[model samples]
Target: MFKIKHVLLLSFTIIALTIAGCKSQFEKLRLSNDTGKKMSEALKLYNKKNYAKALILFEDLSQKYRGRSEAEELNYYYAMTLFKLRDYTTARFQFKSFADTYPTSRYAEECRYMGAYCFYLESPKPSLDQENTVKAIDALQLFINFYPKSERAAEASKYIGLLRAKLEDKAFSNAKMYYELGGYDISNYKAAVVALKNAQIDFPDIKYAEEMDLLIVKSQFAYAKNSIEERQEDRYSEAIGYADEFAESHPESKLLAESKELRKDSEKGIANAKSVLAARKADYEKYKAQLDKEGKKDTTTIKTPNK
Candidate 1:
């Protein structure tokens, strides 16, 4: 038992001594007037991923090396340290600043890409606020435009597509919401039709294209059926047009059954409307013939003053 206690005590002593040695060495280098030594140590710490210590040293060196040749490298490391620490907002700002301040530096292009990439990292999911997503897209596009021959252009383009899809998702949701809205007083069905149409135009290759077009057909059917008799014929015809479009576009869609049903209903509605219009026309003609047989002169005349 005494031997084990001695060993444990010795281990604890060694650990305590190691900690004190590190702390003392760090303090010694921190207070020294030797910027060269500090720069070397900071770089070593940064490369080792000791961002906390690297950050402290880099901050100190940033002010010391201002307007000097070493400032470029120092600022680059400082911005990267911020990025590695997950301080993306500040890191992005610093990266952009680095690029602007050192436009001709070898690291400028990389820092510009990093600035945009930071925004991409900050982007939320499709369902959340997309301000960051927009910024990411804009920044990335600017990067691509600024450096068309860059090796990073392909990756930036891929990210731009991803962010655009997210925007498309938001648009789809808004349009779908209009479809789901209740009450005819709001004309939400019209809004739904307009929204879906715009989505189709904006994203022709949208993954939801089939579903959205099917929805448009359904909305047209509802809008037609609920309309007054005067509008039912024309509206039902429009619904038929939409149904035909969906059928031609997606012949194998599972929603084909629903589209077929909408077609049947709209055709029936059109026939009924036509029949009613024919009956009204016949009744008007019959009344006019009776008036003619009665020799009715229903014209009115205004006589001018005799001259």
Candidate 2:
């Protein structure tokens, strides 16, 4: 029984040692005062392109110096590490937080630019949802507003312009699709009008606005031209509308002469068809009366005519 008691005490002692060793390991991490040393080490790792290890170290430093002067440096390093590691969302968040918390810090402007860049990196093609594109544009605009003299300002402005153009292209393409699919009765007017408006807004000084306006006039003319004769007066009336619009919008267009000729043809066709139909109906009535009179005379005078 004494031997068994000794074994039990030895086992308990070993377990206690193991637990203390684990506790000490955690305490070392918790109580370490080597923040600057750790930061330097992480920077070295980052400069060496050891992104994973650098990320871990920077994250630890960010936590260690949350509100200290080192905090901004720590956050910047952390965000850079995540960026190098291709962890963009976390990098974006880290940069945003750093900028927001230290807006007046020396590193603040860099953080703002990089934060917007992170969003720019996340932007997808226009075929995809434009949530990131919009965010990127807004961030870039804010960066310019705050740092108009920044060396990066021109580049940021250029990117914002490209992104806006991409979005406008998507909008224009969608509108054009409606016109192509004959969705007019379903409100194609809206699409054509919006397309022209967007082109005007986006490329007001370019040839695109002029071209889109011409297309709108053509589409409106075609829609009205398809109506029946009884419904055709409205068609000609609408054609005149497009003629007027085209004349006013593009008076010097090479297409002006053709547009005038088409209008004249439509007017002449309507008048000629109506006149021909009336003339044929009148001739048919007169021929029927003559036949009736000849038949009655023949029935009355048939026997005397034989002699």
Pick by TM-score: which candidate is best? 1
Off by over 4 Å in 2: 1-37, 183-186, 198-207, 226-240, 247-307
Q: Indicate the TM-score of model 2.
A: 0.66
Q: Write the per-residue lDDT of candidate 2 for residues 2-42, one digit (tens) a residue.
A: 99999999999999999999667545643567877777777
Local accuracy of candidate 1 as per-residue lDDT tens digits, 1-307: 9999999999999999999999999989988879999999999999999999999999989889999999999999999999999999999999999999999999999999999999999999887889999999999999999999999999999999999899889878988888778254436777889999998898888988888989898888887777766678888999899999999999999999999999999999999878887897698778778878998753535344221
lDDT of each: 0.90, 0.73
What is the total number of backbone clashes in candidate 2? Answer: 0
Query: Candidate 1 lDDT (Cα, whole model)?
Result: 0.90
Q: State TM-scores per candidate.
A: 0.79, 0.66
* Candidate 1 Cα misplacement greater than 4 A, ranges: 183-186, 224-235, 248-254, 269-307
Best by lDDT: 1
